[model samples]
Target chain A: QNSDASNEPHTVKKSVLATYYHRKFEGRRTSSGAKYRAKKLTAAHRTLPFGTMITVTNPDNGKSVKVKVNDRGPFSRKLAIDLSESAAKEIGIYSKGVAKVKLSYTLE
Target chain B: QNSDASNEPHTVKKSVLATYYHRKFEGRRTSSGAKYRAKKLTAAHRTLPFGTMITVTNPDNGKSVKVKVNDRGPFSRKLAIDLSESAAKEIGIYSKGVAKVKLSYTLE
Candidate 1:
């Protein structure tokens, strides 16, 4: 049984350290732990530790929001981060779908 | 003693049942419980019970993903639901700040 584990293909590779976008869905859940919430100003970075704060900015409108890194994601190839519906609207990203954004870590 | 509790400004009001968008931060955390992860294909809604599954569809690209409603949010007047970074990219919501989408509650 242990031999088969090594034979499995490691499909997980880190893409852009992180990316940004509006509200949409296109990923799968790998862990079965507790769920995360969208209403809270939170985000998911693959490498960032949980509870890390990051500033998310909308390049188009120049609107920015500080979010706590609570989860992990952007599992697909087409998008980056998923904004809560409210976060997208607050930064003026909901109209078009996805926006150019920059996420910077906030020192705790 | 309890009179002040209810007298306190009831600023909390329901907005749009729910909404959609890309990666951004524009809300606040109401609870101090365990944090939510964005990369886990999860979302936050005000009324959805924990573990409720919902389908988030990107109206622009027509991509959809199923997510579990695990938190509450959109505390600001700007956004609706927040997406995980990965989910946004998968559904093509990362390019735009936010997308026109529909969230349907899945019957468990």
Candidate 2:
């Protein structure tokens, strides 16, 4: 009985197509009702609840960033999450427009 | 200057010992005068200025988190940055209490 294991958060991991928000989206209200700021570390998921935090990683470069889910996005079923401009840049994919990333989220 | 390169943000990178805020600091006012909330992705740095955002990565685990510099100090010269609870958790160092992390910040 490893009690600490149960006490710790449970994680659900997935591989997804990552894209970033455009500057135009700045000042727009997100699904969570928060204004989307290009420089904030935030993201959008199809169905994750507001305030859910996810660790997104570009495995190729081992670059990762934790982003808060504050909107619903990517709209295309093929894409998983839409990262904020700053979040994407941190993972070295802002200029690329898109990339494959590993998403790790905890159930809290 | 390559026009695009000049227009792009510049990065400042460093390796630091990362510690996280304790639950007791849940409602305390940070140096930036904002109440510290453990669930929010935020961090404290000695001199990066308020509102600066940093991408912190645990290289060993390839996990990272983007946190805003909303507070000040670990107070110890040997320590570099103080991350929030959720941020630390995202990087798999919540229970560890401390770890070495690579910090990347963009100068816009």
Q: What is the TM-score of each predicted model, taking all chains together?
A: 0.27, 0.33
- Per-residue accuracy of model 2 over B1-108 as CA lDDT, tens digit each: 123435455555555444455556778766566887766777655435567766666454565667677765544323333333334445554455445554432111
Interface RMSD of each: 17.9, 21.4
Name the runs in model 1 displaced over 4 angstroms: A1-108, B1-32, B78-108
Docking class of 2: incorrect
Best by DockQ: 1
Tell how far residue B86 is off in model 2, in angstroms.
18
Error of 1 at B63 (Å): 0.5
Model 2 over residues A7-100: C-alpha lDDT tens digits? 5455565554445555567687665668877667776654355577666654445656777777655434233333333444455544554455
Error of 1 at B31 (Å): 4.1
Give me the runs in candidate 2 sitting further than 4 Å from their true place: A1-8, A77-108, B1-108
